[model samples]
Target: MIEQSLQGRRAFILQNTTLEPPPHTPELALHVASEITPIWKMTEEALEEIGLPPPFWAFAWAGGQALARYTLDNPQIVTGHGVVDFASGSGIVAIAAKKAGAARVLAADIDPFCEAATELNAQANGVEVDFTAENLLDAPPPAWASVILAGDICYEKPLAERVMAWLGQARAAGATVLIGDPGRSYFPRQGLTKLAEYQVPTTRELEDMEVKKTAVWKLP
Candidate 1:
């Protein structure tokens, strides 16, 4: 979910991806991989050998597309507010929030390459999104952020547990917390309030089904 890209990674992105709108949220365009790109054929070890991590930034995941749709449709949730987009792969959610009139948006990811990828996507969308390669989970949520958005963060048990605990802290501090998940195993359901759900279109490569039942949830 994070990286600080040297020139090579950014170059790879520029060479490999095209400006295309995600299937579910077609209102915004991003720098994303196409089926024909070399990125798809590269293995994890191959990517690592080139000093790159898995190119999560190259695809728009289901959770992010769901949250982007919800936020755009209901701008009141983020309009005129300072927002933070956590683990912002491809900057899809961040760009959507900005388009929906968020006063300011900060996109944070630990991957160095995500910084470059998000920046490129933001520019392509004609929106301004401040991004940090910093792993925001390493510290407290910023005091000025009134809205916090996390997408697909529950894919891993340890990450889901840590993110939920941290988001809980943010909620306690009065920030509105929202998560987009496709019923990932590590994502708990009992305590959260569901706001919206969608059958998000996804690729077989990225999800179990061609369309996933995903939901947007608010931390109680």
Candidate 2:
């Protein structure tokens, strides 16, 4: 029954959105909403009807774009390693990791809709990425993950704190941890080493500015 419901939701999302390449990462395509307001309203209505969270899986956020661009350019960072993309959203970073030749890629998110979106986007890019709806933050980092990727995850204060702690643990366990951020209020100002930065093009409907100076950081 849950599988059927997810399929129905995936169909609804594909019908309402376009499959296009993001501005910064042109090599990969995803099912993306053209306008933020209409999709946001539809997502809100869907949440009211089904008790789901907002549909963040419908857009390629600035931080994700910057991370994806960096991953594609610096393929050696993920090559031949097992990668886990946390808060996977549209699966942009996961796709990039797979394209970069990661031994395996898992896209993890709490939202069931994100699992469906990740699968669809992975197929579109001709790469295989496993999807998990589990909230992996509730437990220790998986032993199989040799590298962990997080993109645009520091929006809320509490969630950001929790994720940063978990990511720190992962780093201590010897897994390379990387984060893509647009300097949200919740992002920790300390303990991160910057790797790359990009002026990611974004829509004003979702962000205050048209271009976000996003950066990818390594957690130590």
Candidate 3:
């Protein structure tokens, strides 16, 4: 489990020891680094340092842990490939892709703060990744990446449908789309292949229930 020094909370990591939960800075996890596993707490000082504006919710969802764990164990999938983490909650998936030998990695999210968190965590993890705050669906496809990674995006139907549509377009353009979800209801079952399955642990924030197991999946 990783111990989050910022929040003083500990969580189990996929491949190794638990990581200290990241500081509860909006720019760190809620915005920038979507790949780092969440520890479920944060300090107000850390939040202030990141310039988080008032009237913001403190809690967040991080799906990149499961994706990162899978990538770390399946290096062949990302080795020397160009990768992108779409809807990157904390850039966790992109960071994992880089660790797994991707030639280049990009963490993309709609929230500007998420980009900041991605950068912070990338630096903390001793890696480099391209971070973007734009909504990819509104912008043209990034021609640089050949692989797309998504995690926990199926929780919401409208968003999930939009992302899946984009992934289909990306796939049609020759890019591989891989998604890691915990069996959300909106997850599209057809036109995708289950590359792997993992019993990912989850908390109440996103699940809206007690802790439970989540499944990881990949595309054809």
Candidate 4:
């Protein structure tokens, strides 16, 4: 069964990674791979053997770290509102929103492994975040979510375009949409109102530099 496979994958992730605090957001801790290459290789092998996607949930990305820090510092943004963290890898931002006093927080990702990782990470941080493993690309933002948070979602062109359009729709529908991006190639140059920026420390294995100038933006 799918649930059984997800449990096995979760065990594998826990076995391979260590629970530690992310560099930029030390207030939160997650189970993350210590070295990037080893996990990258292991995930590749997993892909060949069991059709697993890349293990992006095993690390705290720059955009997510920046967003989490911003949310914690600016609790008024999410407090008393229902939030949805789109592509919620490791559930870092979702946990931050919950800690910031959001009425409800939902972490949604298409990858089942990410759901497992999110659940574990939320528990580690002493936060309650619901998880949904749904591919919501074609769907409109849920009416219950007053805020939709997306992080590091502009890596690819097609996905970037689709997410931007969907977030635009969400914005028009009276939901406040926020995006955290590290200036990826496909990040939109327009239609965003910059809110905050952070020099997020990151691993060179994942990015070209040791620190990424990341920013949080509001969808227009």
Candidate 5:
């Protein structure tokens, strides 16, 4: 029997989808779905000029194509590592890490909808992940061997600052931190090392970013 989250809630691993609507239960679908196109429409020039999008709505934001590509290519990086998918939207990165053979995986996000989405998605992918709706700045799980953040902390200033601070603490505690982003305004450019780059789909020329430029960075 395939395990699933409790009724009334579950995470979903969106396939061929650049994003997932928030709350995972469809009740909040209006908010989540509404943000998808607008977020995609965000251009590098726009981000550079506007700084960050106002956090007006809640959505289970998967980093989309870039993150998906990274997981597909570097499955080995997560093999045997205890992993945490910070800001896990639709649980894509967590699912990818699980596919990569991470010994354990946890999908953490502040949005309740994201928690449901992560759990459902992980189950759909035949992967088991611990899902939680909690703020990272408050208190992070103690046992995460590695932290994998994809495309979230770079979108807003306060969120980026908080996640970065948490990341620094996690790094100091000897946890490996990896970040995948497609050039958001708040991505820290100072201490991170580039691991790889991929062409992920974007809403630009392709039907759904058949390919867009994205990069992976690691904090040592």
Candidate 6:
């Protein structure tokens, strides 16, 4: 995949977004696009022209917020363990894992912009998180990941099915797999145990309502 340089992407993010604490998790600050309309309203052709995908990294999604909250509250789940945050987006969950005393944290995403965003967000939160633009879904889940966390990943049907199967493999390989979902259309509820529930505040532009009832589920 053709990718922009980290410096260029970082500049673009700083110019477009403001460092603000997400509504649900105020303890951590993220570089979020304050004016959501301009980014969200951009046409597909325009995005292609700009060589960018949907700016999922520009928002603190509800699923991510819920997962971060759950991690911070239940530190034992991550403390001293190597954790991986798949489809890391703004790296909120990864930062939360580090803050909760994780031994190491990796933020994996295919979005080229996510490497820069995750790096900046980790710095903003005073946490160190390694990031990879490599699409982790293309291969087997890392066996070293003692815990795997994913949020807001089940958006499209095909991708949801693929990710679920990959995560299931990770579970069978002895990794603790946790998913944070805000009722996405393709998210599978079966074969998962509810760990926590949260009412997360989000923008109406992203969801049907201003507040989303989100939940954290653990793979059994």
- Clashing residue pair totals per candidate (backbone < 3 A): 7, 0, 32, 0, 13, 0
What's each prediction's TM-score? 0.91, 0.94, 0.71, 0.94, 0.69, 0.94
The CA lDDT of each predicted structure is 0.87, 0.89, 0.62, 0.88, 0.59, 0.90
lDDT tens digits, residue span 47-151, model 6: 356545567888999999999999999999999999999999999999999999999999999977788899999999899999888888888999889899999
Q: Please, what are the lDDT tens digits per residue for candidate 2 over residues 73-152?
A: 99998999999999999999999999999999999998767887888899899999998898898899999999999999
Worst 10 contiguous positions by lDDT, candidate 2: 45-54
Clashing residue pairs for model 2: none
Q: Lowest-scoring 10 consecutive residues by lDDT in candidate 5?
A: 22-31
lDDT (Cα, 0-100) at 20 in candidate 2:
96
lDDT of 4 by residue, 94-159 (tens): 999999999999999987678879888988999889999988786888999999999999888998
lDDT of 5 by residue, 138-219 (tens): 8854555665555556778887888888888888887877787767788887878998776554443222343445677888
**Candidate with better lDDT, 2 vs 3:** 2
Question: Which regions of candidate 1 deviate over 4 angstroms?
Answer: 1-7, 35-53
lDDT of 1 by residue, 179-218 (tens): 9999999998889999999999998777778999999999
Better of 2 and 3 by TM-score: 2
Best TM-score goes to which candidate? 2
Q: Name the TM-score of candidate 2.
A: 0.94
lDDT of 6: 0.90
Candidate 3, 1-220: lDDT as tens digits = 2233423211121122223442321122322212223322232242333433321112234345666777778888889989988877656677778878999998887654455456656766778999776778996568878888887777779988988888878887888777877667899878677776654444554455444344556566
Model 3 stretches with alpha carbons more than 4 Å out: 1-62, 208-211
Off by over 4 Å in 4: 1-4, 44-53
Residue 195 lDDT (model 6)? 99
How would you order the candidates by lDDT, starting with the best?
Answer: 6, 2, 4, 1, 3, 5
TM-score for candidate 6, please give it.
0.94
